[model samples]
Target: MPSPTKETRTLSPLATLPATMQLHPPPSSGTHRTLRRLQSAHSLGAKAAAQPSLISQQRFQAQNQQQRQQFQRLQPIQQKPPSPARRHVSTARSPQRGRANSDAAPVPTTTQLAAMAMTATRRSALSKRSLAADSMSLERLLRDGPPNDDVEGALESARLKILDQGIRSDSDGMSSLRIYVWLILLNAPVLETDTYLSLIHRGPSPAYSKIRNDTFRTLTTDPLFRRRVSEASLIRLLNAVAWTLHDTREDRTREPSIASIASSSRQSLDQLSSRPGTGHSGYGSGQSHPSSPAAKNRARALTLTTEGSETSMAAESGTYVQGMNVLAAPFLYAARSEAEAFIAFHQLLTKELPGYIRGAMDGVHKGLALVDKVLAIVDPRLSLYLLSKNLTAEIYAFPSVLTLCACTPPLPEVLRLWDFLFAYGPHLNILCIVAQLVMIRTKIMDSPSPNKLLRSFPALQADQIKRTTLAIIKMIPDDVYAEIVVHAR
Candidate 1:
């Protein structure tokens, strides 16, 4: 066979080709189109697999766009930008942003609101206290006559002010007017510097050795007292008081006896009645008129009797006592000068608390007894508990009685308590003592040894003490309260 043209040439079929090996029947047109479609699909899948990140990025962008549209729909409407000419005009009219929305401040939290309220309350209270202190100035009250010339009314007003609004003090707790108020309350007369100096020049008293021994110990622990008052000043004041007391004792001793005066007067009256003209018609008749010699003599005898009783009482009181130092400390601390302190101290010893300094300290003993009695009545359970433990006011309340609670610490609080005591009556100190016992009754009862607990009292709190004292006053019987009043005297 000759080779045919390229398009028409056909090689001779291999002889008897196996049916399995025969050339595949020419593919049908439908099958060929199906195969072409499958090829195109496979090619597209391969392209996507080759660059997956690009496809993923495109899908992610589509999702983000949808989210942005949703978010924009929820946003507040925004104003359009102003025209350039309008903006220029607006800027010229107003340099700063308007504050029309300034009133809509953010709401404060609960704690912030509470803190603001507390600050405002504190300011209001401080203002009220300042005004009250100024209005109740004791110096001003003394300089300007009392309103309506009511001295007692003015004093009451001052006391109420002291109670409601405490006296204003400097940072050191010193009050300029406290001494003056104390002088007025104590009725201490003004003394010349010369008088105090004269007493100082007279050298130490008979009690000087004893006074010296105590001088170093007076308020030894109180920094304020030590800073303000010196040992020499205390010595001078105490020595002056001792001299006054010594002179008083000597004067009392020199006084004529009532019995002698009475006997002498009786003898004179007898002789006068024995006279001829004065016999039956005069003193002997016992019908003498008020102006008659017999009546005058009798009146004089009665006066002597009254004076004798008073003298005997004075004689019982000693010139100096162990606790007088403590008693004088507050006066010294409060006074502006030694002379002032001297006046107050002398007055207190001779007038207000003479009984307390008696040779036996009978008044202190009485005060202690009154404390027990008052406690027994006011709080029977506590009183019974104490009694069972062999605890008596005598054991626990001696210094309190002797010093008028000046033995307590925190001199400022003592000063405040003194204000109340001097204003009302020093006798109320018994009530105050009882009030302290009542205040700690629960603690005392709980303790196994109350004596140890009461050995030294807790620090003074003037307000709480006063309130408790007032409450105790209401509960006590009248007789016991009266005893409390006079026991100190």
Candidate 2:
């Protein structure tokens, strides 16, 4: 009920702490400095609290004045109109030295405007070219129909069409034309379904397990390949080819050949003539039978050598290899039917690229050496750089050679390249392998670690490769190209 005392009213919040709190000694210099700042802040806060409206208005006016200054600086300066020549000269003089002022409006120079126009025009031209290219239809190539006698011209025309305009990809519903063009290029005649079915009916091949192992994994990452071609279908086709190869080998082995017999007899005679006391010894000497271990060992060795030659012949004829699935995948993907795929694949293996799937894979090795030789000829600097680092083509290009460059990603691009190779000659694949190195020569040379770069080559840009491959054919000497022919054989 009574009025408050003056002493009580003057007591501050800090004053309410117990005297025990102040019993500590005066704070250290750092603590004392912090205390002074706190005291100053407290006094300023109290003063601001006394006239909050005035403080807010002052802040608002300060913000407006700053904004007005910014706005004034942002306004563009107008100058007397100058002659066109002076305008361009003035723009050309401005080199854009450094970071622009934050307050000033950006003023593009006449040179910048010209550059922008040029870039826009370039973009428009590129777009038009692309549109023109897309406008070419598969029907156009087919409408001309295939030539009967002039095979080279027909092939040349088809290749030109493919280069100018990509094939109708499987994504498009018009792959029938693509298949037809491929058939023509491959020189693969359309096979009857009955023949293919009969091959399949021969049952699973000795290579069936190998085919199944590879079939599912073929282009597993390729959506187009996976979406269109089923693994089961691929397995069936490979198995049928295996049976055909097996049957053919069996037929050849069962049939007697005079050449084989004569060569074998000549080899035995040569062996007998080579050994001491061994010339027609059965006529007078005691040894007619292979009774001694030494004689028995010699006889066994001859048998093995004969068997080895026969095995090698059969393998070179048609036995499947590890990478054959990848080699055949592009064909199967492009071909509409299993029979077409089988015939194309068979032709590719037996005729086009026989050495690739052979027991020794001699073609792959030769191709690797050819890659080195071709690269040395085309891009001598990059080739030497790689060789200096011991990064031979055998280390990096084995897959490329074996698969005929189909192992590269973006299956669509690979297919386009094949159209070119098949139309001309699958032999051109060696040139293509060289083309990839040419495209990325700069990157490889610049990198400190060339092995890392060579470990995985860049993705295929088929158009670029097709052009480069063509260019390489001209760049390389005829002798080198001849070597390319002999390398794969």
Candidate 3:
């Protein structure tokens, strides 16, 4: 007991303690294994918690990417309407990297692709005289008797025949007869080359500035128009017409004796504008509008001569507007010479549809309104839907009405439509406008933004428009048709 060793003393104390209270260390291998198991379990729990969030984040990114891609697909390219020379461009989908999965849906065919492929029957030129010969035939029929004879019966017969068979086909080349046919329908007097030559020699027109600005841009996208038509020719033709109008007005103002003629003409103008039947009953219908009213008024009232004058008459008829160049393009394309084109274009503005190109373009505005009215009549449901979205004719049909639907592409189709217009009545254009709305009524009603559909109307299906137009015409009342006659003039 005296001064016992430390080990012995510690052993003596543990012997006094209960065996259960004693401490002992486990084997190193066992302790390490237990710690490893705990660490593995904790890590497994952490991974399980993070997996859901990671998967959700990836799914959201994929969804966002898909929406972006869909938006890109829906965005339309900024382009003029489709042209005849432009063939169908395939929209077949190429396999995208992330999107090519087993769950992805297959691509579907579009109605538009089918429509684009279905072009109207194109006419071939049998000979250069085909169009002119047809015109001559029509002339003989109309002039079968005296000039003052009741040619209405004969005129109606000829129109029906031409409408059934469009002014010669434009199969491979331009139809030489289209110009003559257009001139005949317009009742424009035949002119010698000297008339146009004289006008050109007179130098720049009072509207030269506006004409020059628009000439280069006319139908720039159409291959035929761009390649075949020279800017110089268009400028010259428009300038000459402007000069003729200016010269005529200046000549009229200078002669006091013509004052009485002018007064009577103005009175007649007031009457024609107010009374539909008294005016030209058919626009582009091959029937002549009395010259005393339209011609005299244009000459006397629209004194838009030299230097863009601000007089009411000058403002009404003075400088060129935005779409005149486009309006003149079809004329130049069909005419053999500037003289022929000049006569047609001049008569169109002054006699055929004076209100269209006037300073205010009131006739164009009226045409737009009539388009809306006609649509509402033909398809009330579609019209109401469009009206609800504020998509009126002015927003979409302005160019079509202003250019007689020539503003849109597939030049061949436009030429065909013009054939119908010339043979029947440009007033039929209103019916044509209604037909357009009817053709795609479903798509328009389904669209969230119909303006996009209207901004540039769907490509011209000449046959479809003509067929639909003819059917619509039969349904229209005589009174409404009369209103359409005067709507643009």
**Residue runs of model 3 more than 4 Å from their true location after superposition:** 1-154, 248-315
For model 1, how does the per-residue alpha-carbon lDDT over 1-489 read when each residue is reduced to its tens digit? 110111110111111123432212333545434433333332333234443232343343354445435424422222222222111110011122333332222223345434434433322211111223235466666556355544444554555455545666774558877776666666555566776777788796766876776778777777888899888888888888777676665664432322233344343112211100001000111212234676345333322111113443333545566667878888888888888788767766655677687655667778888888988877889999988987887667767877888877778888888876765557778878887887787799999999888777777777677766664554565456556656756
Candidate 2 structure quality by residue, lDDT tens digits, 1-489: 111111111111212213322212333545434433433333333334343333343343354445435423432232222222212111111223344334332233345445434433322211111222233354653554333433333333344456556676653223666656665555454466676776677676777766765676787767777888898888888787676565555575432232233244343112211100011001111111224575344323211111123354523444566667777777778777888788778766665676665545667667877888988877788888987877787667767777777887777777777776665567778988887887787789998788777665678878777656755664565467666665555
Q: TM-score of each candidate?
A: 0.59, 0.58, 0.59
> lDDT for each of the candidates?
0.57, 0.55, 0.55
* RMSD to true structure for each model, in Å: 42.2, 31.1, 33.2
Worst 10 residues of 3 by lDDT: 274-283
On a 0 to 100 scale, what is the lDDT of residue 71 in model 1?
29
Which candidate wins on TM-score? 1
lDDT of 3 by residue, 1-489 (tens): 011111111111112212332112223544444443333333332234433233343343354445435433432222222222222222222333332233222221234223322211000001111222334455454334212332333343344445555566556338766776666566555465665676678787768876776677778778887777899999998887776566555554422222233344343112211110100111121111223365345334323334446644545455455567777888888778877777778867776677776655677767777777878777788889988986777566756776788777777788888776765556667778888788788889899998776666677877777766654543455457567877766
